[model samples]
Target: MSGPSQEVVAPKAPQRIVILGATSAIAEAAARLWAANGARIILAGRNEARLNKIAADLKARGASEAIDWPLDFVTADAGAELGKMVDRLGGLDLLLLAYGISGDQGELERNPAAAAKVIATNFSSAAAWSLAAAAVLEKQRRGTLLVIGSVAGDRGRRSNFIYGATKGGLAHLVEGIAHKLAPLGARAVIIKPGFVETPMTAGMANNGPLWAKPDAIAPIIVRAGEKGGPVVYAPTFWRGIMLIVRNLPAAVFDRLNI
Candidate 1:
């Protein structure tokens, strides 16, 4: 009776995701979006109470499963902890490194210890975790490692050069990892967002049009994980903005107060 047979396609399977620095506003927002897709997620952070609360919220939001793993990002043995998490999850589809600190530029300039802490948290610790996750993804020959970077990293400015430097370093690191994973069918993505309205930036003057909410940036992060990336600028406009800044002459750039 039928003239021709139609092909039937199966629905895509749910993703397995891990969010380090799960308590951060941006990470939480992204996790929420993933949860709605029936993803299985793990929330890893130093604050157990907050992680538990977030895990419960994600579950309520329709995540297939949500597990909280308390972890101190700075001092933890990244390789060992990541291996354990991979085992617990049975495998990994995506790992998001979202932990970072934007220390007071003035304080960082004055106190070496303060600057050190910022460097350690934003660059050293983040890089360690990234490498661990990269290794896992490489071994599996699949998955994505997504890291949150900042637009400030596009060019070093007087206002937040320390933080900017760390982000710039992270961008380069992710680029290398991306290259390494390319042959293996794995991916590493770095998301650079500008002036996000998160708890971290609450104290800063962020009411301007350029400032964006964490929720607004979360979708871009999720898309990058699902698709592919080495570098992504949230809102997409920042790429143009940064291109201009990065190409500015040193003499002209030094005169302006950014």
Candidate 2:
């Protein structure tokens, strides 16, 4: 029998973390930036060899332990497979779902199937996999879900409506998830970056005010996670700029053609 004077013991902290899109440039940078002193990691992605390499690299660079779980996002059961992997990892301190596919707007306009696939990967697939994370975080009542979004989602663009629409849906998804998850002690952070140079956008011009490389943007994400914030802009300066951008009249905004 328990008495009022008796004290209960708290569980130990979780050491394992899983990054669903392990091979991505920003995700790997995140792994490096947030390794802590000697954390354990479970890298999961489409390429088993790449995941293995990432795991080995993490272990070499201050991570106490690291392992790879092969996961293919193109497969039909990506969500279920990732959920099982997270469960097997025992407990996750952070779960990052950062899958993105660049869509060719010109081709997408001609082919409905192409646009549909891109949307599925960018929005539907991400949502499905994140549901897996949400379930685990809620059960644990203590974990973080970080999703990398883009400022392109803030407004539709003539050059890439297909891609912008996908990101728009993602923006909405992150907002909804953050509100629902906050009270449970589990939380989500939506990272809206303004033009980072990655393999994804090397061909694009880099003249924007806060344009930066993935390396520069990564530290911002790590800081946000450490500080426990729900939304973060990669350069931090974009917060004020976006506030003004969002408030401009649609007629003026359209004529300005940003």
Candidate 3:
């Protein structure tokens, strides 16, 4: 038999999708995509108002159902609370974990608290949240756990090495979690987008052929989730770019300003 076509593999399903960082640009956009594709949405975040607003927007656009689940990723009990939220929601067909922080490395170098906060937001919270989701997903024995990774993690840039380090750690964490969860009939998809036009990146320059919008990034991610992509780069080209950068000769690579 001929293998399934890519189109056949990625058609949208009218299932329940929970967006953990529902207020963030990419997460909000992903929520909208799933909502538009006939999924019920559980918009989750620390701000009930923000999540409710997103739910209202999703309902206006024809989602089957929309609800808000207020969650604070920074809390000491965040992991356990997240596990409870999963049970309360009656299981999820898709889980989107997309919270992040843009760190000011200069200030972080001087302030230990600032440094820890960034690491917590970018790495600790993310891993914990994904782990919680994976626990339920594994028990169900069928579901997807998708989270945003960072291309910046592939290699360090002097401009934001601290941020890069945190993301690098996240990339490894999710990849390992994905492998562990695979046998449980659950899988993880890691998304790495080269600068996107979102509130977090509003003032940043578009890096040559690498820039993309949150709108552009969201659909690609949805498709990846539906089709079981392990690690996907938004806009596609970044895959080739990262491959080259990751394998560059260290002697010559260190000389080039990445």
Candidate 4:
């Protein structure tokens, strides 16, 4: 005696969207979704060939327009590069920073240079782009700047403490920016995903039920970006997972091998 469930339609996607690390799997997935929704997209990444391919694919999928701008994000010109992206897009409605690296914990423990590289890529470079994007969006008086963080950032783990630490830094940075952007009518949000099965994590054992695919997680990113919240956990379940992890006592948490 139950009626069929009604389908809920999503709001219109951002018109002008800029993805800083467009070559990443999750970012590409989000790009395709946005393209399908008729969003204009600007793809910025290090690999010109990959960026071009994604741009073409987005066009084929229905984007109003799709274009690529190649740049290495870990340079002095990173902020300038972000400025160029905003300019190229004509104006920015949504900006996503999705570049990151999960470094080897043992290697980092033994090498200061390795630790520096991880910090530079996952934290410093991201911060530069976020700041640069914030300046433009704030002046424009509207836009959402979204950064892809990780659940590892909620609590540092022995397995990937360096990566966790960098993400933790990014989480705090976005939190502060989110507060600041409130008055400017712009928004900055941090999205933390847990155990996403991407090329970056291909070496790990990802057979568990908690693991998420790029396609599965992309919609969550779009939803959170559209809603303009301070923080979001992809898959929704990670919110509960991180809540328990964050609340566990040090004595209990330190003993675990997670």
Candidate 5:
């Protein structure tokens, strides 16, 4: 008698991914994970040299193909530029928006120019790229638009309310995008990470139980890109922490130094 019939499983297609602000620590870490899975990646950022270096490293780490494109997110015409990128890539699987700036809180408070720059980088530019990616995903009727948000957005704090406001605004924006994509079989996710030890937060006093490394946060990002809810908190505990922070009585909140 012959053996029982065997089943043949087809190989999965490699992911085509684009990472805006590809030089950021957390973004780079997430790209590494995707690369190991044989993803074809395009890195967009202002630093041509750094992007090239990261691309080479990704290729070395097992990416099917990795390339770099230098882009200045603040001044670019996001919709037009993103259309060009999508065309070049032939298709899209995920678009990760990871660029941001954290101006000194004291300087931002006193310097209108500095504050404006922060708002432009963190909110206005980020939103534009997000919407552009959402359009691409909608048209394809698949894929995910994953944006890097921060736990700082959960509530206004005396220390970094300006930055917090940008993130908070971004959270709401992504919520709407998520709703729009759901029926179309697409997805948009906002990743809210707590204190991550990246170059952006290098100057801050970071020793604490709450702080997390980019490598530790990267896996959550990779999973979310594949399949995720509208809003996710990396390290998971931040969700509870933010819940407590968001609901605290204003009278008591006002007295505490955050």
Candidate 6:
């Protein structure tokens, strides 16, 4: 009989990693860390200049290979493009989806087009890319899929519910996909970060103990992809914070401002 001390080991560092939102602060932090560890990275995003700069930095930081591809996820053919990337890399060991816009909540409420853009960027495009990537990983029967979500997704708050709704939708989709992929030896991880100091939140008053820097959260995201559970909260305390929010009774929750 096997001993109680037996433990399953995590897979090796992924050789080829596809970062969908390569220019995002958190993603770029993760890319640099992975590059330093010798991962081959394909940085895909809309900003060609930013992509090139980050790719060069990754190479300088010791990435085995660093390349970039220009992509506007809202209009691009996700399935075809991801297929080409996987083929170009020979095989994919990890795929990170870290792009999203924190659409103005008040503006979204007043503008239908603004709301649609948020939905497209946060949910529709991500779903499309996830399906495309899932197909490839399923066939290969290996790889890790890491998605950056938000704690707001745990429940709807009036402050950012528009953005929260999109993230909530994504978390639900990936949860179902995780089960489906498990049987095939593939893993899907959802990283729910609290208040991070990124460009997306630059306009907001992000100072104080609650806000985290990109570099602080980056390692947690990478480790979750490398070896961890399906859902993770960067900095970890956010998990407890959200648990309280989620379990609040409807009447009590509605009376207070979050």
* Highest-scoring model, TM-score: 6
Task: Estimate candidate 2's alpha-carbon lDDT, on a 0 to 1 scale.
Answer: 0.77
Return the clash pairs for model 6, or none: none
Ten contiguous residues with the weakest lDDT in model 6: 2-11
What are the per-residue Cα lDDT tens digits for candidate 5 across 142-220? 9999999999999999999999999999999999999999999999999999999999999999999999999999999
Instruction: For candidate 6, give the lDDT of residue 254.
Output: 95
Q: Candidate 3 residues 1-258, lDDT tens each?
A: 997767435444637787878898988887787877677877778889888888899998889889898878867465677666666667778888888888666898889999999998988888888888777778888788888877888888667788888888888877887898888877888888887888887767766666787889888888877775678888788889988988888887888865
Each model's lDDT = 0.92, 0.77, 0.81, 0.90, 0.92, 0.92
Cα shift from native, residue 164, model 3 (Å) = 1.4
Candidate 1 stretches with Cα past 4 Å from truth are 1-14
Show model 5 residue runs off by greater than 4 Å: 1-14
Worst 10 residues of 1 by lDDT: 6-15
Model 6 global lDDT (CA atoms, 0 to 1): 0.92
Count clashes in each candidate, considering only residues at least 3 apart in sequence or on different chains: 0, 0, 0, 0, 0, 0
Tens-place lDDT per residue, model 6, 31-133, is: 9999998999999999999999999999999999999999999899998999899988999999999999987789999999999999999999999998888
After TM-score superposition, what is the CA distance of residue 187 in candidate 4 from its true location, in Å? Answer: 0.9
lDDT of 3 at 99: 82
Better of 3 and 5 by lDDT: 5
Q: Which ten residues in a row have the lowest lDDT in candidate 2?
A: 6-15
Q: After TM-score superposition, what is the CA distance of residue 149 in candidate 1 from its true location, in Å?
A: 0.7
Clashing pairs in 4: none
Deviation in Å, model 4, residue 74 alpha carbon = 0.4
What are the C-alpha RMSDs, in order, of all predicted structures? Answer: 3.3, 4.7, 3.1, 4.7, 3.8, 1.8
